[model samples]
Target chain A: MKKRATAQEVAQLAGVSKWTVIRAFTPGASITEVSRAKVMAAAEQMNYRPNLLARSLATRSTRQVAVFVDDFANPYKLQLIEATTAALQAEGLVALLVNINEHLDHVHAILNADQRQVDAVVLLGTSFREETLADSRLRDGGPPLFVLARDSQLAGIPAVSCDSAVAMEDICRHLAARGFGRPGFMSGPRTLSTALGRHRHFRDHWASRGIEVAELQASPYSHAAGAAAMRAYLAANPPGARIDVLVCENDILAHGALDVLRHEAGLSVPSDMAVVGFDDAAPSALPGYDLTTYRQPVGRMVETLVDMLSGRRPHDTIVLRGELVLRSSA
Target chain B: MKKRATAQEVAQLAGVSKWTVIRAFTPGASITEVSRAKVMAAAEQMNYRPNLLARSLATRSTRQVAVFVDDFANPYKLQLIEATTAALQAEGLVALLVNINEHLDHVHAILNADQRQVDAVVLLGTSFREETLADSRLRDGGPPLFVLARDSQLAGIPAVSCDSAVAMEDICRHLAARGFGRPGFMSGPRTLSTALGRHRHFRDHWASRGIEVAELQASPYSHAAGAAAMRAYLAANPPGARIDVLVCENDILAHGALDVLRHEAGLSVPSDMAVVGFDDAAPSALPGYDLTTYRQPVGRMVETLVDMLSGRRPHDTIVLRGELVLRSSA
Candidate 1:
């Protein structure tokens, strides 16, 4: 194996000092451009590297933000984490990611265990809520926090999320406008407010429109669970007895349900069964699934969340719209 | 909105003191088992939390590891990050994620940046190899290095990787045995050692068996690049070139190329074309892709890497075997 390149080796080959190589990597450092080219040429020849750690350590205020997320498998949350991290990194901030799925106590333990290494926290798809108010870490002089989607009663905190109530009502209207006869809804676990809101809104809004909901209950937001739900429904009766359309809580669940229908149950999408999903995860949009679903304005959410963290949009709530991507599915 | 629960709230709810609730989150902190259960039960009811920062600062270990990856869009790397994070969290260590697409310098900046807090660094993919090695971050007392892949000659460093060259030979032999003719291969950039190794091994082994090799090169391990490379290959060939078999560098690239073949190029998998992927990312086994491929043991990689970090494993180099998964796409 070749020895990893070093700045000294390059310096020796080019007959230049090690500092010359440093200046080449350090953008706009005070040095002759010709010397920089020479350093690069030499470095290419021998692969010399100067220590970047001390330089990084010397530069105070590394703009790395500690981003806390739950369920890395969940595409919506993944997108949020990705969007926020990309946006922050573009602005020269590193993202420290923490998961909250272990347990609530452990989740907070992670926050404290991390020891405030992060400049601030971007809480994405977290279960953390008002109960943290009494914790000294959060209550006292802790790093400022920007929560996304988590509901809170207390004032003086900043948050950015799609207005859950409005987003849910719009989904219901879209389903109703499609002229669906009988609709069964497969929603996420009711524990999360976002899922609960969608379930409650779909039930309440559709009832007023004289559409009787057949099946309604909480299931984990996964393709497996969606497929299982579809399988169970199929076992209960023949295709004729099934509902005309099924509204899924999110894309993961929707894709799973569709998989069972198309692959296992041998049903065609939008033909034998029409389906609509939320969050519009990649798999759901694949040519195989061809899922027509709601898309949260993620780029906007990241923009507003960053602004909130920087104190640009404090004391205000953000409510964004969701678009329905029309496709081979519902 | 409900207030986020705290240890104090748990104390109030459980009829115990706040200190009791604090001790509950600690793994083995001394406290009455009954009281611990009460604190936990109360904490669960109210979603109680404690300050992990103040305590960790006192302990002087962040209990966090910063993970640097090229991009999360590559499903394979995303799966590795997910597994690695789960493993770290299982060991009471949290992962801080960094996406280097928009800014590669940010990753080094984080690792070398001393003021930034972290216990160690886990470089996730090939991106780490590209950074100038002479940089101090690669050497010196920068949190003990743990890289995954072929032996990188950074003295006293630890590495983890599946047997890529041997694994490619396994696939090539299987294709040859199946009477599949000279195949079309999609290789990652020549700059990447993993890509270079896999491509070279596949070519040599196929030539040994007197099978011709038609190959395409992608910029990086990604879906778009995979699609673009295939498009270039198809454009260069005659209408009936019959490039029936494809071996992709990884799962994400394979899926991307599959999408282009089905949607754009108008071909069927396994019938008109057989495709295989590496890294067995979870989605590859999902309903649509169900790719025929090699499964790199991520669980073992994380466990082995962490054991190396914790001194459980000897300083000798370790290479693992990849599991071959055959699905309909083959």
Candidate 2:
């Protein structure tokens, strides 16, 4: 690679001190308007950019946040990633994407992020065990950690996610109003931190109305898993004794359950069986699957995350409410 | 933040020189077995991680690659991202995600990557004008750039993508063998580097067989755009003059076209109209759609990219062929 232009050369051309040139590039630094203008023009002409990696050594701020993601099968994770990355960029920080999967587990991902000295780490739609975070090496002497679009019961780790309690209440009320007597809850992997809470909310809300609820667990949030779980459920129970309404933890699972119910089980949605899901993914709005689901406040949640990272807001667990979109499926 | 353990502290604990501790952490550094083992134990006891940012200044390599992605609506992009990030991690490199969109354009993203002194840059599914790359500031004194999963006509820039020439031929042959004469190609945005080649391949291949093909352009590569384009095509042409088969640029567009043909246009697939698409996205395999499309070899392409970055392979364009998955749609 060719040598880059130096800041001293730009300062000489702009007829200003080197300190003034540095101040012009630094955010919120004190510098005269005329000096900053001259310095910027000279820097642009010479193609001089301050080396962020080199500057990070002195400031201890790399301005890069490591974002850990594992569940790529769920379409809703893409929306969360886009929103979080854009929000981070708006605050002049870059997102270092760490794909945590079977190859690279959560413990190794956290160590890599800590070694890079990132400003913070954001966990998005991951399915690692809670004991992984309990490692004292990860808990001490590292950058702050935050969770986005998922609930966290761990203390001192602020999480900004949709309020599952409110969403479950809304879904149960809608189902009860429609006079659906038998309800079943379809959940993703049990390792997910948000799974137990969603199941409890759905069951407790239904028990209040004097109705018993059934449950099924699908490992790994994917359409195939959901379809297989639904297939097994249908085979074990006869048509008359089957659950009338099925509540899925996410839209992807709901899509699979709907497909099996219609094509294989020969059941018409909302007539023979009703299905509801959380996370209003884009495909749910299509003409084929007009699913009634809850839309998470992704943009607002990401904004709150950015505010906490930048010290503009206190580090506390925040639960925001979303809208319940009613459609023909439910 | 708590103070990190220093190299001197590890050296004292291990009863060795400080340089020995550094060599134990550095890859490919020469040191005795006993000394290296002793230093590693001491470093692990105190959680001492070498500061990569500080080491980058002396080595002139940050071991980070900037991945530029813009189109999130396409589900195929997520698979490419997962494969690329995992491959990079295997090579002991990190991926710095750069989201290029209306807010952060390609030029700005490139400059940011340049400022950070990343080892290389990879452009993935971006839609930017070719002239934007002609900027001298981006071309000179910057890290090497590569394009993944997209063809690049620009000279000296290596691109690893699926062979459109071969895939189009397979699609055309499949259509002709099925006795389809009136075929139309549904294209995405005109600015895409791969659009013209795909359109040309479809038109020329059909011309060789003495069959003329009709064309329609959809902007933004979204399902809604595909639906709107199909709606306009049907409104313009009568039943007798309508094209019997439609080939979409990607699976997402094909899904929209299929939905419109079935629901609004009141046409049954493969009997009244046939639809085909590329990319073989996850939804394409669902029971509802069952689309016939091409699957890009994302893992192989990412492996080739890593080889190019690590100097194990030459910097040249590589075209890999994928399989043509057949289903009920076509």
Candidate 3:
């Protein structure tokens, strides 16, 4: 009980060879019922579980999962990893964390390669291009691969994502409720699939709702862009240049808008100009910002991501609802 | 040519089964030279690398490393993971991420049993308690276990840690260079052996340099504690209450001081109050607070942590020298 009760000790008590003790835990592993019962009884007395390294010779799955994330330093990614790791641990699956840069080549390598010790791969979706999924390894035959918040045409590779379509609807409806008719959208780069999907879905939802979008398209997703976009929009439509509500693709952009509203544009959040953002990140909670945001449900999303691989969850596209946290910024 | 080719395809092309292809990659594994050359030639043709799942079968070492973190959402832990994961991946090892919340008993059980298929464990320095290490799986001859900036007595567990002794010296020397006398420390809980070690080392080093610490340990390291300590100290000792320099444990705590300084105490960072923080986090780089701080070499530490695990590194304390990043805060 110092750590592991030796197989020799189990053998000594059960009156059998160490090999017999090893065979008891090996699944689909053949051993006579009498010997198996004796070994199992002895193991139970000692409260022993066989070493996976030795018993894996007789097992099907290794109970290990690989988690891939694009920038570890990004607070948002960190939150995802936090919940995902916890979820994996609860099911007793080892979460193999892989740090990948913004490179599709590495992702393709993961998909095509079956030589890595991981039982499966969990892609923490962030700015993935469609071509990245085109890597042949992801096409059905590869070890069960799951993408977080991304959808792919390939079969069998399941995905767990937030309902971006519903998220957009919530944002638009919130804007209208705030007594703002013309709400502007400042988004991220057009290349990244998340940004693109959000943009298209937001537009389609708004169009169906009968609200004509005033200003749309990509912003740099940085503070400078938020300021520049706000200034440019006002400059062009100076006469009726009044967009009382603004929707940002993410929290950072919304932060920039808040600053621009007070410092540059001489406006305030929830007063002269109402704003909304996605990803209820930590910054939104700070005393200075307190932004009204669509909470990503990071806990549920990451836990569900882990649940999918362990067969505790069905291999399916899961979309969770996001709650809008009404804070001072809105 | 695009990525990795699977062993199954290589075996088919080589006119052999998958087991024969696996034996070719297994070190000192039994296989004929003629068959070996034939398999290698076929693998070369297919551009194949044996995946970790297949490789783990032959070798108990899964090329999977487990990093047990205290909290995932902490930006500091995120930085450590980024560096650690990237470093492990560079050596072709997949990092298994685990969060040990309350159930240390079960967590250790999982690690000892190899439930997640990890080959090694790296405890996050700040989060891991000493008691946790004393009862680790490494003691049971399971797998290589390492800790970051951990205490002594974990014999043979390779550690890559920040030289907090050197960090304190650098912070003290830098503050002295800025013409500040009687610098005070606002550090957190020493529950972590590293945090306690830093506090002890800092006090001794500063005293040796003829600089008496103006402030003793305030409750613990936190935003609330930092602000509370400052307020209490000012109330008690009004004349000598405001020290010219304040060296905080981290950026978060330093931010707490900023709030106290501007709003509560009526002082500015560098002008009226000189503050320095360890861990030059992103907020330190922002416009509102350009904090002069120590940039923990998380990347270097992570690489060393992983390398030590595979016996590619020496079993000794590798101290990383944190740089003093001077900004407007100091």
Candidate 4:
């Protein structure tokens, strides 16, 4: 590797003291234009650039944020990460991503981030355990913690997510207004408060309308899991079941259920079995699926997150509303 | 926010100087057992954690790596990022991600990362422009740059990726063995050497075997782009064309082609129009697609990358082979 040009070398080349070289590079620092010009010429000739790390030590602000995510396989999580990074960069912040696939790894990453002294920490799609939250090591007030998508209900923790309960209520009413009678819901693991909240709201709303509701649960929120769950449900209930409309917790699960309904159950979507999904994911908009879904306003959510971090808005539980998109599937 | 405990507070409570407090917190620092015990007790009582940023200035090593990615929407890239971050954390390093969506934003992010004095920089799926690579600002020897999944032929820049030429050869042989005659290729933008390499190899190998080759190009590497490209190709060539098999650049494009064949062309996959994809992405394994694809050895690639960054291996271009997964799509 080539040796980096230092301020001392540039200072010697410019025939000035090292302090003058530093002042020339320092933003808003008072330096004579003659010295600054000489330093700039020397630095440009020698390929010398100001060292940010040393400047950060003097300035006490790195403008870097640590971002944590539980799953990278899920497209929805990927979208969230992408939007978050773009939003952070727009405000002159860099995103330090930590993939918390394992609990121990998450804790270790958090410790490392604290040691690095990032400006803030953003947690995405994470359902952190209460023990982890209560650990005094994590509560050292090192960097401000903000959880996105998944709820972290611990005291003093800020959370931002789509209003799943309200979205589910809207979906249920949409189905009812479309003259759908029996409804079936497909979901991910019950441990996720996001999915559970939607499940409860859908069940309660359907029960209030005196309509029977059938439910299926899967884990890990993948296409295969959704298909397996649907197949298992069909085998137990047999074909020609009365469930006219199927509602899924997310687009991935819905995509799998759509496959099963057509190929396995020999049912035509919307005509025989209408399907609804959340997240209005990119794949769901394809011609094959074209699923009816709740579209989370990710842009607005990201903007709000930036606002919270910049002190333009208060750090608290903020629930954003999503749009119900009607497509061919429903 | 809660105020954090300072070393001065711990030192006052422990009846020792602030230097003793720093010694107690620093690893491998020489200090008396009596002073250490007192410092530890006071620190625990006062909830004091050593500030890492201040220590980094004294030590001059942050143990952080900056990761650059071009497309966040691509699941393939996300998978690579996830694996890379996990591998980095395993070796006591943190990943700072810079999303290069726009040229100016990318340059700004790069400059920031350079200033932060990260240990290294890993660029993922980036086909860097000649001007960007040749610019003295980027070449000022800030950090060791390693490009992943892109062929960067620039001198002093190391690259690692799947052996696209050999992988394409294997795919051609496999297709020939399956008696596929006319073949069609779908790809991302030609600017990407990864896609262009695959395209050239496929076209060359097919031509050598006296087979007709059809090609379609799409920018942005998205499902909608793939679908639009397929629709355009079909409209120009009409249905029932001689192209019996379609080989896509990635699983996403293959997915869109599958939709087009069924919905637009009214042809069944494998039976009438066999479809193959690369990357073996999560969605390709769904029953709906069940796409045949080549699976890159991501685990080994990540391990090799970490090894290269740590100097366990020399910095140079290394190509790894992938496995051809036979599924129902082909």
RMSD in angstroms, all models? Answer: 8.6, 1.9, 5.1, 2.8
Q: Candidate 2 — number of clashing residue pairs?
A: 0
Candidate 1 CAPRI level:
incorrect
lDDT of 3: 0.68
What DockQ would you assign to candidate 4? 0.59
Q: What are the per-residue Cα lDDT tens digits for candidate 4 across A93-172?
A: 88989878854555666767876777788988765564566667777766788888766667877878788878988897
Q: Assess the local accuracy of residue A186 in candidate 2 as a C-alpha lDDT between 0 and 100.
A: 93
DockQ of each: 0.19, 0.76, 0.39, 0.59
Give lDDT for model 1: 0.70
Q: Best by lDDT, which number? A: 2
Best by TM-score: 2
* Cα error of candidate 3 at position A171, Å: 2.9
Best by DockQ: 2
Measured with C-alpha atoms, the lDDT of residue B200 in candidate 1 is: 74
Put down candidate 3 lDDT per residue, B1-330, tens digits, no spaces: 243467788999999987899899878999999889999999877767765554565565677776777654345667777777777777877666777765555346435535444677677764555565566444554555677744444566556777788888887777777788767777666565344366667678778878777653444445556677777766766644567777776776776676577657776667777888778876566554568988888887777776677677776867888788989888
Query: Under CAPRI classification, how is model 3 graded?
Result: acceptable
What is candidate 1's lDDT per residue for A88-139, written digit by digit as tens? 7666666777666645463464355334435577677665545564465454
DockQ of 1: 0.19
Residue B1 lDDT, candidate 1, scale 0-100: 33
Give me the runs in candidate 3 sitting further than 4 Å from their true place.
A1-9, A17-49, A150-157, A193-196, A204-244, A256-274, B1-13, B16-51, B106-110, B113-117, B149-155, B193-196, B205-240, B260-267, B310-312
lDDT of 3 at B63: 74
